[model samples]
Target: MDELMRRRVYGADHDDPDPGPRPGHVYVELVGGPLDGLLLDITGWPQDRLAVGAALGTELGKFGPGGRAVYGPTAAGPGRWAWEADSP
Candidate 1:
């Protein structure tokens, strides 16, 4: 959102979209491996699924066609999931 519009709708102090976790929505930061520094929105995902982490499929993977970027929750911090491995 533009600064003027943001100031009008979300107050002057709010310059950008809120990145904090909300009910039914969570944003995680990918910490390492190929897709580092990516912010993922994990809304509507089951708690169990989030706990175990996920194998996110990507076309830009090292293995190309059939690669999956595996990520898992870590003790690093809140909303931080580290790269576990890559699958082909």
Candidate 2:
């Protein structure tokens, strides 16, 4: 998990047909591990990309397979953000 966080996590917009341009939505997916393929959605975040990624990483550190976590939007606005544990 430490290694994963150290590496750059790729992100894309929800509506993007191609992996280009920044969108309001962002997500980080685990490549391999017990939580392999798990996706953490940070779309509702109104902060910069770095902040969103940090939040996602912090949440992920406390998460495990079969576990879940949800975050409410920051002062940015109102929206529900969630991290889902994908079934292996």
Candidate 3:
């Protein structure tokens, strides 16, 4: 589990204050199981309070029990989320 945040480009022109560590994407990994070492890049979902939850649900649904695993945001900050399966 990892929270992928956009890094500031030193040469980019911008007027807004640095949006420090804004949530960009999440990388989920399964540990110690048949699905171990599998990685999922969950992004492009609606960026809202429920984005992570929605993404997790969608992925798990697609993969089923084997998809059961723990995950966390790529970065640590507000709105960051984590989930774990009952088994596996």
Each model's lDDT: 0.66, 0.39, 0.39
The list of candidate 3 runs beyond 4 A from truth reads 1-27, 31-34, 49-70, 74-83
Error of 1 at 65 (Å): 2.6
Q: State the number of backbone clashes in model 2.
A: 0
Q: Which digits, one per residue and each the tens of the lDDT, describe model 3 over residues 5-41?
A: 3433212236757532334644444333333344444
For candidate 3, what is the total of clashing residue pairs? 5
List per-candidate RMSD values in Å: 8.9, 11.0, 11.8
- The TM-score obtained by model 2 is 0.25
Q: Could you give candidate 2's per-residue lDDT for residues 1-88 as a string of tens digits?
A: 4433333323344464554323454555543333344444555645765344332323233455433333323444332233332222
Candidate 1: tens digits of C-alpha lDDT, residues 1-88: 1321212210112354653333454567777877676656677788998899878776556777678888889998857899988889
Steric clash count of candidate 1: 0
Rank all candidate structures by their TM-score, best first, as comma-separated numbers. 1, 3, 2
lDDT of 1 at 38: 61
Candidate 1 residue 20 C-alpha distance from true site, Å: 13
14, model 3: CA deviation in Å? 45
Runs of candidate 1 exceeding 4 Å displacement: 1-24
Best by lDDT: 1
